[model samples]
Target: MLQALTILSLLFLTDFTMAASEDPAELGAGLQNPGYEELPAWFKTSFLDLTEDVAEAAAEDKRVLLYFYQDGCPYCAKLLRDNFTDREIVELTRQGFDVIAINLWGDREVTGLDGKTTTEKKLATLLGVQFTPTLLFLDEAGKVVLRLNGYLPPHRFAAALRYVAERHERTGERFSEFYVRTNPREAEGDLHQEAGFLAPPLRLGDNRRKSPRPLVVMLEQPVCRECDELHQDVLRREAVALSLAAFDAAIVDVFSREPLQTPDGRETTGRDWAAELGIEYTPSLVFYDTQGREVFRTEGYLKAFHVQGALDYVATGAYRWQPSFQRYLSARREALAERGIQIDIMR
Candidate 1:
């Protein structure tokens, strides 16, 4: 449906930088690799100011992976659907890089390595990204040390993670030279939009003004498969879906600079608000009560049951008394079980 679209967030101790094409139809045409808005939860919430991003990542003892792709690229789809879905690969990348997605064909403003503002398409050209799913691994100084021209299978992708994570380049181990020789896993999941999610052109200001329930702000990117899974596999399920209905949901871009009224009655851009809150990861769930005060927040990947519990915690006002979320969840499960309701944490 989106004929005109551009670039996309969940960050780990997460942050993101972007102006994106947020349309699923255009994100990958038939491929299903959406933009950064659907990206997984581990990516750091960043300003897209590469210099600041590099400094922040280094402060956190993390490196950076500047991922370049465009709409309708099959290899890009494979990278998200296959490589990133691998648990080991996800965890390995999580332990190492703060991944940022950049659209090779987008026109969104990007703050370049030289502290100059440019569009995504221009920057991609500057980086010489001739293919979809090009990955530029940057060191602490924001300098590219390794560049993978196109998609690498899961095994090689795993090796890439290790190569960068362990500083293998310092040992003179080339990526192609040290490639992990093993069978690759096939990709999984149908790339579809998260149904029942708060639809886009998110009018978050209106949400705060109209709803009396707590606010649930989902900081996401289009390329986030985990975010996709949360909707496709988890949030759309019966119980969790109902649980989420209690809040006024709004999906926000981590990299957006557009100003809006926040839940706490402050006027700020999403990027500035995210920075102010020190958001570290993608697909985060930040909750606010009727008074616009933040009551609770979940900053990274969480299973269905926990996500539901987090929602319930705020909805039921459990956070007011039970400071320990773990304790509250334990008591919740016990109470549910006593009533003959069994909770499936994963499903």
Candidate 2:
């Protein structure tokens, strides 16, 4: 009985040891010990005193490279271990940036410009920090020059840092222009292909003297996968493109920093206006009259044919008589087919 009990205890111990070894968080924490001598000289393993360091760096006209991370953040650990330790990234960052790492959920006290000391968690909350591994390039005055969220591989991270640094050196050019020039991949028709279809110039806004025609306003978020897919697949199709061009079309970024005036005459930020419109997801299409009054709204992804049918229903005001939008679209397509107008309604 004693021999059998000893064998079972050994098996339990072996299983526990193997489980701990395989856990990424546990392995990362073990490797991140403060006394670990393997860290490169350029990389500081210590927590940064952001209050003093950031202020000093800003006063010197040096860009502040602020990395916000949290304990048990797998992406943050990877960024620190791989990206921050890359030879090229370390060298470039040393030249132009004062790098600092702050714990997102840490209890460390940080002194503000107003001389008030606040915890790191409070500061993160105040700054709207939601994701781990957030990188911020800040100007001397503490204004954000560029903000990047999530994990990036070493090469991409280095390139992004260099792009921000070059933009900072340019005195006359705006960050947007500099970014496009420095990182052509982020320019229109490249990494940001969807930006091309967001033709705001075609929309009726306060700048217009007269309403050109009825409009369809598409409220979208930049990072929304559904929005990207819709733009790439359905909106880019030839039939849908031709159909959409018939009306005054506009695309509004819900997360834009600019202020927008709603149809109800309430002035709010673009983000707030989108929330007020009850848009909880991407690819929300809202049809409006020439006066910007909401006529109908559709949320979620739609295929090219369905989008075309919806546009027809809204354009002809057939939605009033139809019991449902989907039913209206079906009847509209059949009616158009009977009139010998061939429309591709597949996929």
Candidate 3:
């Protein structure tokens, strides 16, 4: 009897240990931490001081490029492997900018351009870095001349490099103008119309005040493959479709002259408004509150999970309380985990 009782106790202890050993991240959204990538040797090694770095780069007749990334990020890995590996791109980047990498969830001390000290993670939060591999191209004054929210394909990435490196910003030409002029590509057909999107003559000024729903203006171009992919694939997902039900979406061709009233009650054409907003990337989704205030925006290639998260982030009014979209996503993963729902972000 004593021997049998000891064996039962051992079995219970083993089961408890096994349960405790399970990864907590798996219980939530399947946010896999892709292992770290070895940064290029030519990448600038710094003490993470933004002011000094900007000054030093300016002294060399170069700009500052802030690369925000996280461990195990596939897109980040792609940017390094695809864009950085190109000889022309590497040479242009090395000659024109001082690149500094900041981990999205790192603990290293960072002295910001504002001369305030913070952790790398906090600095990311302050900059509102919602996605991995968000790159900020800064002018000599440390102003973000251009900000790429997500990964851009090689052609567009190279165009962006030239736009800044060639001092197009000083010429008063928008990056969008430079990109379209320099790197025109044959894209798929017209805007993919959805039943959920509000038909044109979009008086967003009226819609915001009258309806309780938020506004999502999709700034796209006729010649954009990414826009085509977004409409054909990402929008067709069930989760993304469900989230669209919560907002009044408007699809506007960034180059079109369609007359529309802006959210701030200004009468303008779609093209003018898009230029005014600095909508550089095609298929940029700009979200606005019922009060006509801009809430959140996403301007690069994104999968279904992230698209849905962006929709839900503004739709649920979560942006009011949670300033950091990354933190909000973390909380969302935790909440979904509690309900036994696992999400694959890359899916």
Candidate 4:
């Protein structure tokens, strides 16, 4: 089954080397001795000139893919090792786009599409790059047509590539819509039900005015393997369940046209609201504060630990002071370690 394969792949991802060492001589030869992130050799060696890079790729009748990464990021390693090694994905990438890597915290100078000059880190900030492996797919005009905020496994990542490569956005169809229409997977037959979720005839705006708890809108599809795992494995954990207790949770089928009141009091269908929120990944958990403002969200495939962390991050009102989820995760892990508990992200 796909769910079994997904879990199996995640287990292998835990073996990535994170030890500190000098950068490898040949990047992307698999995880070399060095601990630093290794990009695929096929990634374009560029001068970080966005304007020129776009033009050059356009000349070759290809689009541009800007890969933003950080050193020692496990997901980035998974992307390079797992996704890039797929012959189909590699060939599709080579045929359609010029892939360029940009270090999220590097000091290398970069020229922006707006003709402004900035360092890699500064440009990342300017572009609101909050997660590693954030991919920006640009059109010939240097406009980002699609932006992926975190790592996606090969299947979804390939769909993303094809979406941009075929210029689906030019037809006025969002990537999320296109993906749903093209790729339909087998599921457990129905949406997973949770006791914590709000009852139907869902009026989120009205509920927010009555309850003081934060709200979490889970956007999922019936035909999703990850969604099945989320409900079957991740949510069943005690810590994860406890964290879920702090919020008023709601689950919506992203492809459904069923009407519901949004947290901001807008009447819209689940399908429309999902497209508005850019819900590209199934089983995306979007968290909002008590006042109806978005605080944080997790859109990638994550295990129980990270899921619990995201819940605690919002439930504890930590986002008020800590804007960086990665930093908060680090501090959370260290705090747990002091109590003689070792947390594994893939677990």
Candidate 5:
């Protein structure tokens, strides 16, 4: 029954996507006009001073949602029309946080948390706002607690609000963990197949070809929405598709009983191994170094930019130098921008 509902949902969404129009205004039942900069009145009217905004939100006992969007971005429209327009979501936002919209390409002055003034575009660049509809949930101290890089459907978006509103991160559980442990959404996309992915009978311990790259074990399940998003948006990117060649990637169904040699050379069923590893989410990428030692892993729904960054991080061996993945990605984005290369971050 769950699977059937998931498939129906997918079909519904597919039809909606296929019926898009060239004119942005005509796209969402004429709910949006392209180039219009108006935002929800509930969104705080700030002096564009992030420090003050954060302080005010803190005083009100609320988190701050920094929404970075552009005028014509379809994902932004979905977020605005499909998600934000929902009365329940609006009320939830009002209760939990003070939402602020920042135009990614606007010239409006913004005083950042560092007490420095910059244009909205410059501030977005500084904060790595590579994708429209990026939502940064900030703590009282102005530190980013959670970052949503793309448009999430209503359920997942609501889950994110609850996660941050309830301060789940303070419990030392990752958002993916919290999400899975709480209200799991119905599946969105099916498990994606790629030619580069290793075929079944996956003996991950054996590298007879002596490949110098690391091993990436993708633990996923069929009809996983997060998994679908990864294949649809992230893995198809030229950079990520190319970067994947640097690693020996394998996918294992978390619920399957298929036997395989683990990275530590232990023979176990996929289900058993996933249980041992506590892989609570589909589309989780567990990176293992050349010697089969666990290096890094991302266990949640991530946008193309973040997913690609993970690939680059493991392939280029940057994880060894930078303790913070976010910091490394910032430096990487800055370097690419300085090189005059355009980044389609949400691709």
Candidate 6:
């Protein structure tokens, strides 16, 4: 009877150990296994070059939460498996912040404000981060809003997010105001103020030859939230604006009665032209080659880097030699990656 009891106990213990090992969420008190369903709607998984972009986002009322992690960092993995994967935290992050994950030991290069370049590991050291899983919160102007060292529990992390969000809601007060009040700077000009607009108007088609460069028609509606966001945020930047100046650009309001001539020689009002283009969204970029042939079209908002890549692809005719647009995009990414410039693929 004793031998039988011992055998049964051993079997039960083995089974329990196997179950726990298989379940990542059960491995620890706070840790939870991640799944696609658990990912926050607003948590952008798209990889982006966060170095310069963070500053620009601050100007647009977007705060950046930058997570520095390495491959074998258990704490970093725990945060991903537990805190970030939590449904509530994911939802909250989606609503409030633009999150970026950086490999701290990565070999990627980052450009500094003074035009100097350094590796990701070197940059981490310069930022005074001594450990993995450091979270740096920056306003749209690239000012450090908060810095959290070591692992943060889900509850405390949520609280930190709330604190930042509440502080950000006070519009009249700039990030510089709060930062300078606490840590005074000798510099007079606001760093946040220098964060320029993303998109600007084209030079009204100066590059037009007997064969024009290309025509990029933007379909916009007055009160469209996405349209307004793109116009004010992505398109207003100097780089984007200058690139756009090389093309014949026009913004047509969908409700307008202004006449437009289609590539097919058919004349119609701007409203009808929008309908013919099958543009259901307020902000859509329709690209036409020199001969007025539709090369490509992208609907919705795009960030600066992706937008730049897309423009470069179409302008240089890179698509003609590539297998597909997707492949071309991959090649572009690899090229940029080689130069240590990361671009958000989602955009």
- Taking all chains together, each candidate's TM-score versus the true structure is 0.53, 0.43, 0.49, 0.50, 0.47, 0.39
Q: Which RMSD does model 4 reach against the true structure? A: 20.9
Ranking by lDDT: 4, 3, 5, 1, 2, 6
What is each predicted model's overall lDDT from 0 to 1? 0.74, 0.64, 0.83, 0.83, 0.79, 0.62
lDDT by residue for model 1 (1-347), tens: 23332211143112222223443445465644334334566666666788888887788888999988865577876687556755567889888889988878676778988999998888999989898889999999888988999988766778788888888889886777766443334333333345555665565656667878788888754445556666667787687788888888877765567766787666778777776876655567898888777889997678888998998999999899999999998998999999999987666
Of 1 and 6, the candidate ahead on TM-score is 1
Best candidate according to TM-score:
1
The worst-scoring run of ten residues by lDDT in candidate 2 lies at 184-193
Model 2, TM vs. native:
0.43
Itemize residue pairs with steric clashes in candidate 4: none
Residue-by-residue lDDT tens digits, candidate 3, 1-347 = 99999999999867654443333344367533334555777889999999999999999999999999876678887687556754456778999999998878677889999999998889999999989899999999999999999998667887898899888989999999999888744346466678867788888898888988999989886545677778889998888889988998888876567799988788999878977997656778999998899999997678788889999999999988999988998898899999999988887
Show the colliding residue pairs in model 5: 188-225
Residues 1-347, model 4: lDDT tens digits: 99999998877555442222223443456645433644667889999999999999999989999998876788887677556754457778999999988877677889999999998889999999999889999999999999999988777788899999999998999988988988834346467888858977689999888899999999887646677889999999998888999999999987677999998889999878987997766789999887778889998778898999999999998988999998999999999999999988898
Q: What is the lDDT of residue 169 in candidate 2?
A: 43
Candidate 2 vs candidate 4, TM-score winner = 4
- The true-versus-predicted C-alpha distance at residue 7 of model 2, in Å, is 60
